[model samples]
Target: MKLYEYEAKEIASRYGIPVPRGKLARTPDEAYIVASELGSTVIKAQVLVGGRGLAGGVKIAQTPWEAREAAFKLLESSIRGVKVNIVLVEEKICVSRELYLSLTIDRAMRKPVFLVSEMGGVEIEDLARKYPGKVHRIHVDPEVGYSDYMSRIALSALNLPWSSLSELSSIMKSMYRIMVEYDAELVEFNPLAYSCEGKLIALDAKIIIDDNSLPRHPDLQELYGRELTSYEKKARELGFSYVELDGDIGVISNGAGLTMATMDSILFYGGKPANFLDIGGGASRERVREAVKLMLNHPRTRVLLVNIFGGITRCDEVALGIIEALKEVSQVKPIVVRMLGTNEEEGRRILLEQGISVFVEMDDAVKTAVNLTLK
Candidate 1:
């Protein structure tokens, strides 16, 4: 789950990381009130996705009236097709220097990586590509978290003045500690600023908590009150949740590894995965229907792929779910299923009786799905 900048700043503030004072506003009038209270504020559109500034969703206003005007223009606008609903009015900070810092998991290395850069106001990816040398990354032990040596290394990489090094290092340590305690997958601070007086401040924050680890942090759940889609709400109610991705093929798999592999397989065969849908073990017909319906709602989805290597989940049960889902939706795209495990023969027989296409071989199923996607 991702926390908006306001929420992330709240969490970071509790740990002594200096962040700007801000308030969330749902209306232009509310934004005016907030700006009046804060004074010389920056009105930022609140959205889960990134690239808000480049999309003109961020505006600096000298007065409450200007802030209200900017909020009115931004509130109903779409940044890359996603509607903006909330705006954050924050006190604009004066900066003598800017830096980018983050603590995130490196799945490939199975460790947490600390990223530091001198160019902070812009997107990190752009800086990485244009000036790779300006960006410095270090992997740390997930169990131990960031140490003093790591903090010093990150601070040095920022190339800040020697006088401000201590404050910068302290802020980096605080960011790392928050990542460990909150079970955060990403804790990013952009334009970590150095004021004229040598004080450090966090200009913007982006945090993504580990959904799988939410059980341990009830406090986090309350802070992350971002709106959920109806389909996602239903899935969460049923003890599972999904987020739609941009691709042509929708996937349903038993586990995360298998789900990712299925997506990769689709890509390997010249097709992109529309979403990552993990039915998990012991999935029933109802769960299957929900997953399928969610996929069908995706505008980019052109094909469905059900790749199940049943361990505890029987192949016949998964097949029945697929059939039931087909009946529930008014219209659905082509489906290519690959079932191999317990009751594989029975599952294939049932699907064949319905005249549905089923592929026992993974290679053939992926190829067929790719072809269908192209069409």
Candidate 2:
């Protein structure tokens, strides 16, 4: 789940990170009161998305009245299709430099990677593309964890003084710890800057925790449910893309193109797909398991068809998820898997051992699943 900027900053402050004084306001009056206290505040729409500045979701207010006006204009607005019901009123910081720092899941390496850059803020994407060499990254092993020396080495590339390096390194350590502790897929401090007071402060922050790990951290739940159908909502909760259909066969794949093709093939083979689900790239066993369970327990689904051509995803992990769902779910349905890509042989072996057939051809799998649904 993606935490709003203010929510992410709240977590960061608890870890001893410096952030501008801010208050979350639900109304223009609340924003006015906050701005009166802070003086010269920045009003930002609290939406779970990026490019807020470009979308006019952000405004700099020189006075409390301006803050109120900005809040009144932004509240009840929409950014990238998401409604903004809250705003963050914060004291603007005067900084000498803009920098970027983050730790995120490295699926291919199966570890967390730290990214730091001199060019930061909203334009960081363009900067990185234009000058790729400025942005530096290091893959951190989960077992070894983060090391002070490693951070310092990476920091030196930016040509920083020893004092600055020590401070930034400490902050990086905290970020790394937060990512692991919170089961976060991404923890970021974009435009991590140095104020006039010589203190490094976070101007913006983002955190995305794994939805599958949500049960363990009930305290972090804040986002409300979307107005979607039962299966669509369930798919969102499971961190996958899904669309309900009036059919008897459930389709699962890793990408949109592949999923569309799977559904088309199902139709071609005379099978009506009950739903379209994409488990996403580099899906873990738990994620796959959740997807499988969703399909099997679905009332409209009579058969489950899984077609995975893994690139970042490991077929063994996919097989493990399928097996876990079959073992745990009470209702059993006809499941046919067409597995390929990394660890294919091992995945087939695992599925075969569980008395489940794994198909190598998509046509065969689709035909079999469609035929099974007729029974």
Candidate 3:
């Protein structure tokens, strides 16, 4: 589960990290009030997704009126489909330098890794790709924990001024402690700024807690549960994994691996997938119908692609589910299905009877779905 920037900053502050004074505002009036108190303020959209800055979700306001205007523009807008109902109005800082720092679990190494970079205020992926040498990584030994020596090594990589080293290292250690205490998968401070006053402050934050560990933290679970979209909440209730995407081709598959492959095939064939919906293995006809209904309900979905490679889930049952789904949903979108493996012939026959063409190969199915979108 991911926390909004404001929430992450609040948590980090509790852990002794220095962050700019900020207030959450749900209305333009509230923003004006906060900005008036803070003077020059940065009004930031409170969304759970990234690229918010690039999407015009972050704005600088030199006055309360400007802050109010910025908040008015952002409050009802959607950033990458996630509605921005609130904005974080923070005092704008004068930065002498920007740095990056983060702590995350490295699944490959099965240990927590600390990432530090002198380059900040931009996408870390792009930074790493463009200047891999600038970004430093340290794999922490869980048994040894994050010691002062590890902190020194991580700090040395940035080559920051001697004056900032102690504060930066302390912040890093505090972040590590937060990750451990909260069971966070990721805790990051991008643009960890060295202000004109020569103090290190976290200008931006992103925190993602492990979903499996949510049960251990009731407060975090509640916070994240409240952040879920209506569709996301419904998907969770249906026991399906669904993620919204920015495209018209809705995709459905029985397993995570196959679902990913189906989306990849669509992209490979010059198509974009609207969502990733995995119905999981051994889905019943009713579950499949629900999945189909869910896909059809998406406003951006112009076409649906159901790709099933049945093993425990029989192809014939999937076909029946699709047929049943078509009967139930209104304003049914165009559906292209690809079924292979168990009872494949019977499944194709059933779909054919319903005037639905079935593809034996994934590439062919994806190509057809993409073409239908052009029509």
Candidate 4:
């Protein structure tokens, strides 16, 4: 669950982190109104993905007229395939320096890692590659998140003045605490700039929360779901990617890693995975049914693949779910099933009886699935 920049900034502001004043605009006229209110603002297209500046998603304007022009241009554009419909009109700060600060879950370590650098505004990966020494990282225990001691360590690592370090450190710790409390995967503030007047302001903010944990955070749920259309909210609520793609193979998987692998495998074997869909763990029959219906309805999906590596998930359950889903949809397209792990035999039997292709090996399944798609 990715929160738009404005949403993230609002959250940060609640934690006493300084963020530039901004307003979300749904229309060109609204954008003009916001620009007029902000007076000398930076117009930024709000999207879930990164590299917005590189994609011309961010632009500065000295007046409301220029701001409206930038808004019109960005709102009419697409960044990395995501249509820019919403724009953020924010106050442009006079900065003495740009810094980077972020708190993100380190999957490898199963803990949160705090990152900071003097060289900001540039991508963190680029900084790591070019000037590894400039970037500093420290891992925090999930149980004992952010503390004053930890904040001191981060501030010391950044080599800031003693007087300014306390306030900056507190803000950084608060951001990290928010990340943990909100079940955020990545909470980042890039070019966390220091104004000429000595105030730290977040110039760019991004927060990617774990969708699996949204149920626990009602506030965030309300905030994000507020603007989403009914269909978009329902799609996300079901834990699936309804990303429209120009491909023929609609993919469905149980895990994020598995979903990515399926997409790559399809491409490798000369088939295109229409979209990334993860039904999530322990998907009920109805949820599975909804997923199938959603994929089959996709105009670009000529074929479907339900590939499951049932460890905690049962193959028999997936099989039954797909059957139930098919019963609801009057017409179904070509589907390939590869069931492995728990209840594998029963699952394979049910699919085979339905005249569907089933495979035990991943490579074999992918190859056969791609062939079916090409047909």
Worst 10 residues of 4 by lDDT: 224-233
Model 2, span 72-141: residue lDDT tens: 9999689877778999999989988777888888788888988778777845578678889988888888
Q: What lDDT does the true structure give each of the candidates? A: 0.83, 0.87, 0.89, 0.82
Clashes of each: 0, 0, 0, 0
Give TM-scores for every candidate, taking all chains together and pairing residue i with residue i.
0.83, 0.66, 0.86, 0.77
Across 1-375, the per-residue lDDT of candidate 1 in tens digits comes to 898888899888998899888899999999999999888999998888888889888999999999999999999798767798999999888788888988888889999898889888889889889999988988998778667788678768987667776776778788888888888899999978877667889889998999878879987676443556655566566665455567889887778888888889888989888877787887777887777776766667788888887777777887788888888887658888898878888888888888777787888998999998787
lDDT of 3 by residue, 1-375 (tens): 898898899999998899999899999999999999999999999888888889999999999999999999999799988888999999999998888888988899999999888888878888889999888888888787777776677667776667776787788889888888889999999988879998989999999999999999998777765666677778878999988778899999978888998998899888899988999888788898999998888888999999988777788889899999898889668999988778888988999999999998888999999999988
Residue pairs clashing, model 2: none
lDDT preference between candidates 1 and 4, better one = 1
Please tell me which predicted candidate would have the highest TM-score against the true structure: 3
Mark the regions of model 4 whose C-alpha exceeds 4 Å error after superposition.
26-39, 108-110, 141-153, 156-159, 223-246, 252-265, 276-291, 306-332, 337-365
Where is the poorest 10-residue window by lDDT in model 1? 223-232
Residue-wise lDDT of candidate 4 within 1-375, one digit each (tens)? 788888889999999899998898888788788888788899899987778889889999998888888988998999887789889899888998888889987789988888888888998889889999998888898787676777677667666667777788778788887887788898899989878988778998888898778889887666665444444566788766555456888888888898889889989999888887888777666777899888877777788888887776777788888888888786668888887777878887887888877888777888887898766
User: Model 1: runs farther than 4 Å from truth?
Assistant: 106-113, 137-155, 222-229, 239-243, 246-250, 260-273, 289-303, 311-313, 326-335, 367-375
Q: What lDDT, from 0 to 1, does candidate 3 have? A: 0.89
